[model samples]
Target: MDQDRGYNNYYSSRNSRQYEESSNWRRGNVNWDSQWPTDRYSNSDYYGYTRSDTPFNNYNQSSARYEEDYSRNSYELDPRTMEFDRLVELLHPKFMSEYLNKILTFLKSNNTEICFPHIAPYKEAFLVRIASDHKNLECPAFDETCQNISRSIRDFLYKNSKLFVWSHSYESGKITKNTADTASSPNVILKSSSSDAIDKDSKHKQSRLKKKQIELVSTDFKIQAMKTILDFIKDDSRSLLQYPDLSEVQANFLYTLLSCYDKPEDGAEKSLLLTPLVEALKIYSLKYQFRINKDTNDEDCRFITLEKTLKGKSSENNFNDSLKSPSPSIMDYQDLDDWNTDVENSDATDHRSDGVPDFGGKLNKNQRKLRYLFDQVTTDFKMTVLQKSLDYIEDNSRSSVQFLNLTIHESRFLKCLNSFPLSKKSYFLIEKQCVPLIMKLRRVLEP
Candidate 1:
């Protein structure tokens, strides 16, 4: 009995040890430190998989792709392109330490010193602050560094201004004008090495440059004056009365000036100012007002007339007084018909001075022919309609034994046809002339 008890105790102890191990595994509390190999738990271990099966492969693949893309794009994103982008960014009012450092590095490399007048107006002090903040330095050293950076940036921009699109300096403007003028004038031949030719070319270019500079100055003044004129126009609706005798030159200058500001890409401030000015001009009936110059005959004529004034007449009362003026002999609208009639009668003996007669040969032949054909077609159509109505009435009369009813209906139909506004020849005159009149009207109304 004691031996049996010992066997039962031994089995119970073995089962208890196995159950404890299983529970620990389920609870994820298996002592890996004691049960597994030391290397198995190491961070460097890849379990049972090779490096190819690990996430490192994915990371390596992406890194390789990034390197390949960088290599492919390196040409376009070169140092020069980056520097240009940096310059454009610097055009804004504020910039950061990163931009300052870049400018400083470039300036130091170039071995340049900053000068006051070279930089943009009112930006030197701000640049000084930027330099101080960037280097955390004091005194003359900070100021000197700032000046160098500023001067370098300005020089760099001046040298490469063509690569960008911002407004050029007044001096650069002359250079551009000279280049453009030279390009436009193919007659001026360039001798690469002839001294006399070079001297002559230089003198010619200088003269042209001076003229362009004067023109540019004049244009600027004119633009300012035009703005004042536009403001005056906007102030009073009837103020256009103030300029009843606006000359062709003055009108053209205003038109050209307005067109320049009417660009789609105009800045916010320009658009805001120009919108009301354009509206005012349009409202004052100046939109379609222009004078024709017979000499030039060019679409953009110099002598454009927006308005004209009468002698001893108030402008406000006679806003459209110019309309009452005798039409120019050159602007003869009725002359075409008269000319054609004269050509038709050129072979005939009798001629009257009542211009073109309003009778047979008076009207346009094609228009008259078209009208006659249309009248004939319309008459035939009306006759056909009348015949069809008579046929229908006759058929009904044959089927019915009531002759009085048939005669009454026929008389009533004839009376209705006579009463129609366009049934008869005389009443159809308006209709006959309608097509030609509309055709002529269409020609006149064409834009």
Candidate 2:
């Protein structure tokens, strides 16, 4: 019996030891709040996925671990694309190092504005801060390092913006560190006279490749801007008065893009698409406000009214306002003036920001015929809206349905077609000669 009791005590002691170890083991494993976690646990009681974009997940991650080239020029010392978490960590004003001030200075000098806020969609405010009141946009030039920085910020913008529609091609492809190291194998080259040529060629190729990729990404952003403008155009409740917050040069770029819109044939689609687009062209004309230099009716000779106002006076004021009036520097003003003369310093400005109408010198047939109508609208905008209802009264081509709708619509055109006793051809006596001329101006001449 005593032997049996001894065996029981030994077994009890062994069981106690095992129970203590098992408790410790369970405690360690319970902290896997993430399906995957290198540091074991998240703060949450329930473990799910340790999402990389958790506002502060890995906010303290070191940049050198991701990109060997984490410097001002914005070059990746290595080919490894920066991971998203690292970007957030680097750009976040609160969490970032002193280098953020350098970024702020560079952006400020270029008149770039970045906002940091609490409520942002997808936490974009922390990742990328871009937008500027200045008309000129200067991305990093062929300098791969500069563009590489632009590319990263732009990527953050590009990815977050995809919640809307069509969206770019050196998408810093995220991969394992081991994989990047393997993929970017060091070149086994001889230490010889030809080494210089080889390095130059390699650099040139890399720069070209990066440029193409970044430009493609920029194109995607521009496309989103175009779509936003289209939505603005269709909503008649909105107007150029509440025009999109774009610089005058940006407005011009959109104007050039507008002319290139592939208008569809007349149908429900035409009424839905082309008609509003036509109105947009008229409203958009406000941005392109300029007069032909009578001497050189050469369309190229057109001068922008915005030069003295937009780039000269207003830009200085805006800069002062942005910089909080810290003694405006002459050198900075000189640089700005240089920028004014050439609004776009990058290679992409081919006629887009040169302040020239995309339409050639010769006015289109409708533009020639309807000069008086549109010119009046340009000169006296408020009065010419009646041009629509007035034209409808005189238009023989107006469908019975169109005529009926206008009469009953309780619009500015209400009871405009026929107020009997006044001729059915009302408001027509003065411009009787225009019975044909008005019809001749039919190509987008209507309101």
Candidate 3:
């Protein structure tokens, strides 16, 4: 029984030892002093777990070993030198060393110098202080560097200014020196030496002025041409006025006149000819008003008087046919038979008892003939004249229709025709001769 107890005790002791070993292995607490290779893990062993033998050591092992190596062999240096070394490591040695040397040299040399004008305090203050404080410094070397930097900045500004001018000119249609001068103040000269650049503005202004002149010339030419056509039509008395036809030939003539007037290269002499033509048209309009009246009755005496007045004025005397004959008074008619006899023998020449003679018979016959003549003139001849006059006005007159309508005196003649208690022949005569002439005058004057 004792032997069995001993076996049990031994077995329990061995199992406990195995369990402890397994727990130590799982916890990563290996005995490196005993298990590690002597040469590899000698004094350079990393912490307790790592040695040069294991490339797969964790971060803690590597860090502890590195710290131990540094503590043993690292040399002490000045704090500033150490810090500079750290900075040099952080930045690169080449760039940091060069920049630091430049700064040191600039500060030492410019000790007593002023770097900028008085107003630029932020940039100038440090420079001035350094320059003023350092007397034994080489300032020329530093000034040279600063000068180079200033030149570079100036060059950059100049390039940008040129670009601005180019873009502004493109946007505003064109750019010239004059435009630039206008856009910028006198103090702001674009640093340009080209003469052509300065002349661009003057050229643009000239071009615009020329365009306006051409427009004015075109308008003037049209006015002159219209005036010419009007004169031509007015001078021709055979034109139809009431409904005048506008022929292509007349239109072409008007167009030709306009074209000639508009000819930019034409001589002054050619243009001078238009002035008289215009004046003639004006004169014709002015003179037309005095020649006629609308009322046939008003015009009847006037017409006789005019013919009488015009007698011997013209080579051909056409007044004889238009003269009024002496007629007997209403009191001379005695009775219906006497009146009938008078009417029947109206064709005869006789003397009344009053010694007025039976001149009434001849007078009545002549008056009838005059009335017939007036009718023919009104329907055919006067109409032709009126139509022609209107045609001229329509083609030439610059005046408005309302102006012409108001100025013409034909309304009274039309009223007279409407109210006249005459036979158809007499009425037709009065209508044709009196109304048409008045209307023609109106057209000429107003149209």
Candidate 4:
């Protein structure tokens, strides 16, 4: 009876465990495909596919679908988004100061995280953090958006600040004078005769006259302005080297003044009338010692001085000698003719020969001839020698002056001549006479 009770107790326990497993399988609450299978998997007839048991798989698929729908639906932005983009477009990162206040206002209202991506998208977030830190605002956490915006703003401020400074510097450089002094200056009054009738002509005629008067006054004012500028330049205390732009401005002003005078048809006539201007230019040239051929070594001036002295001495000598020489009289020529006639008559009379004379006759004749020949030889030789000496003296006196003049004239010819090469003789003659006079005149003019 006790053995039977033991067997019955063991069988009842086994049967109870099987009943619990069947109940769990029927409920289908556990995932059979999961690595840790429950009682449902141990009792299930299906091996792999079971819809009721794969809750984790269903959850994952639903999450993925929700993510894809969220991504697609949220992508299509409205007009408001485009309008915000346009507003941001107005802001240039380089010149951010001009739009700084506006940007700050917009940033305060908008989520900087959203706008930050679009604004200053290139700079690093750390740089943006700096600006935020300076302003005592919450730092746009270090990211690409913050970095780009900060850098762009900084660069913008830097460039515009420089431009502003440059403009102020330029403005400061402009000439400024007391207005009271200008106002206090005396005004000129025009005096017209009572008898001078005012012509009330056509409106166009009056306008034309007024325009011409304005033009004339403007020209005079410009001339005075140039003179003022030149005076400033000439002031020794003024350091033009320090302010090179001043010189450039003066040059441009002078160029404009000259351009006003340059009329195509009357250019030559205008140039002729610019004597005062030419004189001013010459004065400027002298003051500056400006030359196309700059002689820094001072050789040209010394050579020119020596040349002038030699030329002057030679010219004076020639002039004095010319004055000293006696003028030839007509009687001197008559006397010369009479002497030649007398000698010819004597020679013919002495020569008495019918045919070719004997050697002794020839000798005797030759002796008379020899006596006459000897006397003639001595006289002719003495006169010829004296004449040659006088010629030499005259040539020497004139040579220097001629050489100086020739040089000057040739230079002038070279300047004026538009054709082929000049003849050597003509060039020589010009150099001998003209150069000396030019040099002397130049020396007299130099101060």
Best by lDDT: 1
- Model 3 ranges with Cα > 4 A deviation: 1-274, 279-418, 421-447
TM-score of each: 0.19, 0.15, 0.15, 0.15
Candidate 3 local lDDT, 135-207, one digit each (tens): 2122233344443443443344355454322212111111122232211311112222243554565456554
Query: How many clashing residue pairs are found in candidate 4?
Result: 19
TM-score of 1: 0.19
Question: Superposing all C-alpha atoms, what RMSD in Å does each candidate have to the true structure?
Answer: 32.0, 27.5, 39.3, 36.0
| lDDT for each residue of candidate 4 in 1-447, tens digit (9 for 90 to 100) | 232222222222434443333333334434546644445444353333253544355646644554454333222211112223322333344433323333334333422221222223112121232332333122233234544554554555455442211111111111111111111222111111211231222224444543343344344545555465456435644312111212322333333333332333211113333445545544554443221111111121210000112222333221111111122111122213324444456653333342212233233332333223223333333233233333443453222121122232232222222111121111221222333333333233233
lDDT of 1 by residue, 164-254 (tens): 2221221110111123222133121112223345456656775565344434434454555557656655453322222222334444334
Which sections of candidate 4 miss by over 4 Å? 1-146, 149-155, 158-220, 227-447
- After the best TM-score superposition of candidate 1, give how far the Cα of residue 187 lies from its true spot, in angstroms: 13
- What is the total number of backbone clashes in candidate 3? 22
User: Against the true structure, candidate 1 has what lDDT?
Assistant: 0.35
Instruction: Give the whole-model CA lDDT for all candidates, comma-separated.
Output: 0.35, 0.30, 0.32, 0.30
Q: Report the candidate with higher TM-score, 1 versus 2.
A: 1
Residue-wise lDDT of candidate 2 within 223-270, one digit each (tens)? Answer: 565466567545544322222344433344333334433432211112
Supply candidate 1's per-residue lDDT for 339.
41
